[model samples]
Each structure stands twice: as structure tokens, then as C-alpha cells.
Target: MSDRQAYSGMAVTGIDAKGRAAIPAFLRAALDRNGAESRVIIAESANAPCLIGFDPAYLEANRAKYGSRADARLDAGETVDANAARLAFALNDIASYDSSGRFVLPPFPAMKAGLDKTGPVLFAGLGDTFEIWNPELLEADAKVHPAFKERALFCLSQWKKGGKG
Candidate 1:
């Protein structure tokens, strides 16, 4: 990713009364440049306590890992596609940005992530995608996550070194 395109900072934003939050201009530009303007997917994060929001192009590009777990289930001889469906749609929500470049989070996805009208949120950039977090959850993570600063520094060092880290 180019310096301008790289998602590397945090933006503490809030949900409006209409259930929308402005995606930082940097992220919005990157998404538009990558042709991800059509849809934004919001869902409960499988890896953390927060929510993750990313465009479909990223999803499509990482299909083997992000888009499908059905193959594994089939190999395990699962009787139905319940697990696969759960993996795919358990927190799945399809959204679109408004005229102001703000994404609309539906009720289910918003509530699942503990975001409601007037909730405090954090927009954390994770390179290819970004994560939307509840401030409380983010603070909780910071307290318990021992290597947060070291990991952050390491990423900066790697970025400076021109390694795709």
C-alpha cells in the first residue's frame, strides 16, 4: 500500500442518531480507489470483542480464508451447512455509505458491537481493512494486551524498512 493508501492510524468517532459514522477520508479514498464503493460489510469480529468493517473486494480477494469455511466442514462430513452458514452470515450485514462518506450500521450489527445511537467508537486501521471498536472494549484490550506498544512500534519499524508487514 502506498503511504497515502495505508490505513495506520486511529480515529475516535461516534455514531450519529441515524446510525452512521464517518469513515475517515483516507480509508474512504482507499476503498474508492480499490473499487470497494458498492458495499461495506459490517460484522462481529471472530478474532476479537469488537466489530470489523471492510469492503467486499478484500473479502473476494481473500476468499480461501475469509469467504469460505464450507470446504473444511464438508471434509469433516458435517451433515448440514449450518456451520458454514454461521461462519458466513452469523454477523453478516451489507451496508452502504451515505452522501457524506459515512457508513450506515444496521441495528443488528450495531447492537452486536455495542454501538448504538450516541455510542463512542474507535476506528482502528489495520492496513488492508479497518476495525470499528467500542471505546470500552478498546480500553479493555489495551489494559490486558501486554505487547500493544511493542507490536505497534514493530509495525512502524517494519513500515520504515519497506517490508510488507
Candidate 2:
């Protein structure tokens, strides 16, 4: 990915002694430009056993995109987009990056995101946001559907090779 982009490329990083994972240097710089300094909004991914990280600006945008009716809908005892509500709730946890460009993953959220502090973790960038995943979990799921795995990986490869995707 180019230096001018939002976030892209991928890596396998290790969680440190303090349950911290370093955001890739390139991504960090991008985050800075995008108005996220030492802090970021992290949440359990809606459709994956992983953690999703993005700038607070995106969170605000998300709230607006989903419209101002979310709260009203919930108050009416209606079934709203649960995932969006989940994402909205996740905004309560604002994560901070250390001097070394790492962010601590609280134990509860880490466990929920499928990390057990014993294996390499995958970092996948998806433009507006990025994800941290247990590599084995992602790999195992990839095996469940041939087309899904192939298409996803092919797109990832292209993005890593400098395509916009």
C-alpha cells in the first residue's frame, strides 16, 4: 500500500509481555494522518472472531451512516442491526498506543477476540479500519469455503502488492 492510503497490507505480530501488539509502523503513520494519535477505537469484529481497530472519526461517521434512528429503534423494542449497535457500544473502549507503537489488549476483549497469548497474531488492513486475528482461526475458517478463501486471499495479495483493492 502507498503511504498516502488509509490502511493496507498485513503482518503477523506478536503480543508482548504486557498483552500489547505493535501497530505496523506504516499503519501508525497513516493513523496519525487520519487524526488518531496515541489512541484508537477497538472492538470485537462483527462477523469475525477478531478485534477491529479504527480511528474515532470512523466511529462518528459510522454513527451518522447508520442514521440517528438507532437509539429510537432500540427504545421501541425493535430489532435493529445488532452488529452496528455492538460496534456502537464498543466505542466505550478507547485504546492507547505506547511509545513503541503498541496497544494493550485488555484480557476480556482479547479473549473475546480469540487471542490466548500463546501464538502469532494476524493483522489485516481493510482501508478505513484494520483487524487483529488469531492466525489459526482465520486459516481454519478459510478452509471451510473454497471460493471465500481464494477470493479473500487473492484480494489481499493484490492489496499487498500495491493495488488499491
In angstroms, what RMSD does candidate 2 have relative to the true structure?
6.3
Highest-scoring model, lDDT: 2
Candidate 1: the clashing residue pairs are: none
- For all candidates in order, the CA lDDT equals 0.66, 0.71
What lDDT does model 1 reach? 0.66
Clash count for candidate 2 is 0
- Candidate 1, which ten residues in sequence have the lowest lDDT sum? 156-165
Per residue, candidate 2 scores C-alpha lDDT tens digits across 1-165 of: 234357786766667667887877767876788778789777877687788888777777777867668767878898787776665764446889976678888677788877858545667778989887776577677433565445445544554565632
lDDT score for residue 45 of model 1:
79
Model 2 bad stretches (over 4 Å): 1-4, 67-87, 90-92, 143-165
Compared with the true structure, what per-residue lDDT tens digits does model 1 show for residues 6-65?
555655555788888877666677767767665677778777767787777666655566
Pairs that clash in candidate 2: none
Worst 10 residues of 2 by lDDT: 142-151
